[model samples]
Target: MSRTELLRLVFAQIFLHATMTGLRLAAPLLALSKGYSAGAVGALIALFALSQIFLAIPAGKYADHHGVRRPMGFAVLAAAVALVLATAFPTIPVLCLGAMLTGAAAGITVIVLQRHIGRAATSNAQRKQFFSWLAIAPAISNFIGPFGAGLIIDHAGQASGDLLAYRICFAVLAVLPLLTWLLVMRVRELPFEPYDPKAAPTHAWDLLKSANFRYILFVNWLQSASWDIHSFLVPILGYERGLSASTIGTILGAFALAAALIRMALPVIAARYSEKRVIAASCIITVGVFAIYPMVSHAAEMVVCAIVLGASLGCVQPMVMSLLTQVTPAHRQGEALGIRLMFINASSFLMPMVAGSFGALIGVGAVFWVVASIVAVGTPVVGKIQLRDNEMPPEKNL
Candidate 1:
């Protein structure tokens, strides 16, 4: 991908991502204001993945056929409508609708953008470089959307506490998709050979027949689960040990910052490290981090462990995205990516609940050890990933 095209795509990604994330932050706060319980809020948050889990495959297939612009156009519309609806109504039910729609829109946008870049990539290294650059979008938006929306929510009202603050936040988010439209709409799609109907596989699940696809998915799932464990357990761990909420948030923030920082270095290192080597090292390091988390007591020590965990898990996605394209056929690249996203979202959605149950039953520290043990056993499976080729971004100045 040219620098200009990559720049546009990255900016587009930030906007689309920021809209959903900002609304995600706003919606729960609004619901809480309207007398919703924590469980109700959890369900409201769960709606964000409703479409992502079920529609990921279809959305992927759609992108494969239509390319980026049309799919992204639909996403932008859905996100805009979701936010506008939430802004106007500001009810629990309406916010649920908003979460589902915006989540679906963001999910579809990711599928197409990754497909577009993967299809356009000329070499394995280029694919890695591109995905490394792309991977930071979520980390950046994770901060941007929530931070900006919180600022608006706190100060938009005449007073510090007002429902109108949330509505205004939603209104601001509603316009972000328009920005996404302006950035992505004009980018040229790659010239693809006509997809032949007869040659296509009978079902998306047929992809699992490839051992390579299955192994890549397994590794991807494990890393994704590791991420979930940290997000879910850390708060509990911090609470049990009497760490303050801000300290807990700071620790998680350290993880996010470390993940983003590591991706920045991935492009420079792409030429030196094979995806397999990077993935294996990431998994092993995650194992070590998991083992360390329960033993950490001081705030600074916990933050250090969190950053180490973040750096370890951050290396997996760019490598996984590159491998997903290599292990599947060209026509089905979108489908494969879709499957990967679907699987990861499904895992993300379910893993938290599982960790909660495990935390309640086994205690937080044991939960960490158990998950670490599982990852240790599974680390070898990453080495099982055989690929048709290597792929990442060009090692140019990125």
Candidate 2:
């Protein structure tokens, strides 16, 4: 990628991810405005993943058969349309439709972007660096997006005029995809070998047979579940704990900032530890931080723990991304990532609502305790992953 192209990619990623985070922060607020119960909020989140799980493989295959640029453009346009539809007609059913469309579009965009990064980088170090930069997108979004949404919602109280706030948020988001469509327009396509039907696996199912891949994929799922509990549960839990809306927002912002900082140091950290050790150790640290959550009393101490949690957990994805490139062949990249993401999305999609229901039934404190327990399960499984037959060990950079 040229310097100009790289800049464009970075800018586009920032905008796109910020938009996604803004929308996520707004979703539950919007649903509750329409009189949605807690269960309904869970349903709204779950509906987004229904299409994501079902369509992931085909979306990846489409990108692999074609090029990432076109599918990515289409996904962006689709996301814009979904946002418009969501804002124009705010109902449970319409919300579901919008969420489903956006999720499906996201599924395609992710594989294509990962493939683009994979092909763009010239070495393992570059790949890790590229992913480290890519991590900034979500980091910024997570930090800024919720606060932005909260500002919007606060400006237009959730019960009365908040619809306009959401509408404005969605409108701001549309500009991102439009800009991404323009930015990627000038970049040269990475040359790919023809997708011969005979040479390609007959079904995406074949990708699942690798035990190493399966273990990593499950780790991805388990990790996502733990993270989602924090994402979807924190606001609700904060509210229940008598935290003011602004305090809740500040707590989330602090956590997100910590996560962003952790991601920034990932390339350095990955340079020192083998990818496997990084992931395994990170999981252990995350589990430890989460385990301490239930014992915290002071708000500042809670915020500190959130920071530690974010720092530990935020490093996993990039390390996992680096590992995936080593474990899957070039031609099969989309399929492997798509399958892994399917389970990741599945866990992200379900775990929140499950936690929410449990919170409602038992207590809010139980949510963190449960999530900590779930995260702990990944520690033993992290060591089970190995690179593919033709793969090489990570280059020693530390």
Candidate 3:
């Protein structure tokens, strides 16, 4: 595929991912307004991750057989349906269903698009650059989605559980996927050899048997857990420090901005360092961030922590993608990506509950300390990831 085509795909992904992020932010607040308990709200969030966990591998396999565009089209349609369901019904059951649909759509979109990028690149340098560019979409969308939803919700009057504003947010989100669907239709498909059923299929479990891949998967999980914890805990910590909602939002926004900036510079950084070394350094820095998070009493200090944490966490995804693609066979890239998603979705699904419970039982500071301890333990393992000498080709600009 041409660079122009790859960029179009990236833009589509940004919109689709933004829609999912907006819905995730809007769903729980909407649920609470409808008299749902905190547990119920958490369940609504988990439902999305659960759907992704179950659908990820199958969707990857399907994309491997068919093509990325077909799955991409289906994912956008599903996201559109999800937003419509939320807007039209505005009830708990409908919202729950919509969340599940959106989650599945996001999971399918990610696996296929990732596979497409992996296949489109002919060399490791291109893969690193492409994946680095691709990772920025989610970072950018994470900020756009929640901030936009909040602005709409505030304007619509959130004081009385104003349903109109929430619906408006969903309506806006609905249009994004529709636009993406149209874009997907116009973009030319990248060349991929269709999967032949006559050939034996590879099982996901078999992929886990490789020690290097297994280690890479473990590192990916840790990185994902770090992201989830940072997002989940920052607001609570800020609130405890008596920061207003807007201030807390700014802190998180700064983190996201730092992530995007770092991703933009990742290719240059990767050019000078090995993926293992970069990832290991990130893990170490993340450990420090968590350890310092508990001690930050001022909003400015929180922003500082956020920037460091975000930059460190931002280095993880593309490196993991680069390493995973290098270790896996070309024919099974989709499946490998699927397994990676399954692990990530599963972590995302379960970690919030665990973090919340730990916070409740041991206090928020203890939660951060625990996460820091875990990362500290894993630092050596991250440093020890062994790849073949040829895994990373010489760096070149795209």
Candidate 4:
């Protein structure tokens, strides 16, 4: 690909992710504003996470059979359609449908991006930089997306009888997929050996049999669970702490900024240390952050905790992706990644319900303890991952 095309691809990814982030952030507030109760809002929001549980692997496999470009285009188009649909009719069920469709599409976009990035870059250094760039896209989107949604919704609520502000956000989001689809159309297809028709499909159980692969999947799952807890619980906690709506939004924005900055630093850190070491250290920090989170009473203290939370957790995903690429055989890379993603999505699906139940039962504050234990248990397991010398691509050694 030409430098201009590469750059265009980056910008297009930024635009697409920004829209996805906005919709996700806006969904809860939209539901609440529409007169839905807290439980209903939670369920609507959870629908996004829940859809990924089964859709992830299928999406990955779909990308594997077809080129990443097709599935990638389809996902973005689906997201665009969903967002526009939600805007056209702002009912509760329609909103839930929008969120679910967006979630499935987002999941597919992830696998597609990984596949393309895995193919497009020429060297390990270039590959690491690409992943770092990928990390930053979501962070930037998540921060700006919600902040923009809040501003739009706030003004619209004041100026008009309609919830036109959020509807406008959805409408704007609908355009992003087309840009992403156009950009992806220009990418050169990566080479792949055709799958054998006689071979049995890879099972998650078979993949898990390798202890190293199990650890890889486990870390991914824990990372997802950690993130799920924070994203869902933080807002609920903010309300319980009696912070103003704007104040809660500000804190969440800061958390996202922290995450973005940390992701921007990932390439630098990965250059100096092995990806495994980064994952291990990040997990350790994650444990510390989650364990102490419930104990903090003040917003300032909470913000400080969020910065650490962002720093540690932000590095885990790209590092995990890098390592997964190293371990799996080249021919099966797509399928392996599919399984890995499934585990992460599954955690996302299950953790919220589990955490939400704890929040509802013992209070939202109790979620911190539950998530802390989940992350802490993974610390030792992170250490057990081994990239055997034979498994390391030769370029990675230099």
Candidate 5:
């Protein structure tokens, strides 16, 4: 594909992801407006991740067998329908259902897109650069989606409950996926190459059984959990601190903006440090950031934390993608990406519910401390990651 074609695909992914981020930030506040407790809100978040956990591998398999075009089209359309559902119902149950549909759609779309990019790249350098650029779309979308949602909610005076402002947000979000669907239609479809039965690794479990791949998956899970917790807890934390919806959205947006800025510089950073070292350092910094996140009561303080956290976490995705593609066979890239997502989404599915309960009983502050402890404990595991070959070039003086 030409660079223009790739960019168009990336833009569609951006819109779809923005919709997901907007919903993620808005859902809890919407539920809270309806008098739901923290625990119930957590369940709502779990429902989203739960659906992805179940469908991820299957979605990957479909992509591997049928190619990405059809799956991408379906996923975007499903997301559009999901946003419309949430807009129409404006209830906790319906919103939960919408979350599931959105998650499933996102899971499929992500694996397919990653596989598409992995296949298109001609070298490790290009792969790193491509995936880093790919990561930026979501980072940018994360900023636009949540920040926009918060602005809409605050301006429309609908932060309190099931109100017109929230519905309007959903309505606007629905347009993004529809546009993605149109873009997917315009892109030339790649021909599908059926998975060869004679291939060494026929099953997803076979890849999971490899010690190196398992370690990568575990590291991904830890990072994924941290991402989930930050998204899930920050809004609630902001609400508790008496921050407005707009301020909370901007804080989250700042985090995402920092992430985007770091991602754009990842190629330069990878030139200086090994992907393994970068990832390990990021986890350690993340532990420190989480330790301080709970204590901050002011919006400005939270934005500072968000920037630090975003920069640290932002270094992770491109490295992981670079490493994952290096470790896995070319033909099975789709399945491997799917399995990786399954592990992450499984954590996403479980952690929010646990955190929610803890938040309900103990406090949201305790939740942050627990997340910090978990990341700290996992740092050594990140240190142990031994890729068979270093994909990045040796450090060069700037």
Candidate 6:
């Protein structure tokens, strides 16, 4: 893929990812508005990640066998049907179904896209650059999906939180995946590795047996948890400090903007540093931010913390992705990527509930202190992960 095509693919990812995020936001809001309890809302939200946890490996294997365009075609169909069904019905059951479908659809397409882009480059540094560029999509879309859906819900109808308003958000989200299809449907397919009759297939879990792959996966999960905790805890903390919803939104937005800006700069400079060094440094910075976060009473101080934490976590994804392609086999890269996604989605689903439980039992600040402490303890292993030279011939910019 040329730089132009790579960029178009990035936009394609943004549309698909945003559709899932928007629906995730819309579904929970609609459920809460209909007088559902907090526990019900949480259950509805958990459905968003349930399918991805179960299907990620299969989706990755499908991408490995079929390459980019085909898996994406199936995902696009699924997302469109899912979101369109939600728009037509806008009921709790429909939203539950939509949540699962859209989540799986987005996860499948993202795995394929990541597999394709990460392979497009010949060198480790070049893969780092490619992934750094690709990493910006989520940062951008995380903001776009929920913010756009919220805007539409607040202003698109005669009353806020009405059925018509949510339907409109669902309708708009349904169109996003179609736009993703338009961007990539005609793009050329990269060559996939042919199956060997004698060589047996490897399970995705087998990748975890490698010391380096385990280190990468663990470090990736560590940094990702920092990002998630910041997102999950900040609003609760801010609310306790008596900040309004808009103020909390602004604080989170500041973090997203900081993350995106840092990512935008990473592609040009990623070759200068080792992936482990970045991960280690990010962990340290994150620990510092989480330590001081509870003391931040003012919104401005919280925004500063948000930006610093975002900048730190923002650099981890591309570095981890760069490490992944180098650490894993060429043929099983998709499976490896799938395993990574599964771990991530699993954490994303389980962490909040655990944190909520712990938060209620102890306090929210203890949750941050606990995760930060674990990340700090694990930082030393970064130096121990070993790398080996790839035997595959240098790939062209596929």
Model number with the top lDDT: 1
Model 3 lDDT tens row, 1-398: 67788778788888888899999999999888878899899889888788988888888778877776788888988999989988898899988898888889888888888888877777777777788888888877877888888888988765545888888888999998987776677766665558677987667677777777788888888889999988998888888989999999899888888989999899788777778888999998999999989997999999999999989999999989888887776656788899999999888877877999999999999999999999888777776666665453221200
- Score candidate 2 by TM-score against the native: 0.83
RMSD of each: 4.1, 4.6, 4.1, 4.0, 5.8, 3.4
User: How would you order the candidates by lDDT, starting with the best?
Assistant: 1, 6, 3, 5, 4, 2
Q: What is the TM-score of candidate 6?
A: 0.92
Ranking of models by TM-score: 1, 6, 3, 4, 2, 5
Which pairs in model 5 have colliding backbones?
A: none
Model 4 lowest lDDT segment of ten? 389-398
Lowest-sum lDDT 10-residue window in model 1: 389-398
- Candidate 6 residue spans exceeding 4 A from truth: 159-161, 194-199, 388-398
Model 5 lDDT tens row, 249-273? 8998888788889988986887667
Please report, in order, the local distance difference test score of every candidate based on alpha carbons. Answer: 0.87, 0.72, 0.84, 0.74, 0.81, 0.86
lDDT (Cα, 0-100) at 323 in candidate 4:
69
Q: For residues 184-223, write the lDDT of model 4, one tens digit per residue.
A: 8877777765556796775534555566777888887887
Per-candidate total of colliding backbone pairs: 13, 0, 0, 0, 0, 1
Worst 10 residues of 2 by lDDT: 389-398
Per-model TM-score on C-alpha atoms:
0.95, 0.83, 0.89, 0.85, 0.78, 0.92
Tens digits of lDDT, candidate 1, 190-213 = 755444677645477878877778
Cα displacement (Å) at residue 166, model 6: 3.1
Clashing residue pairs for model 6 = 1-398
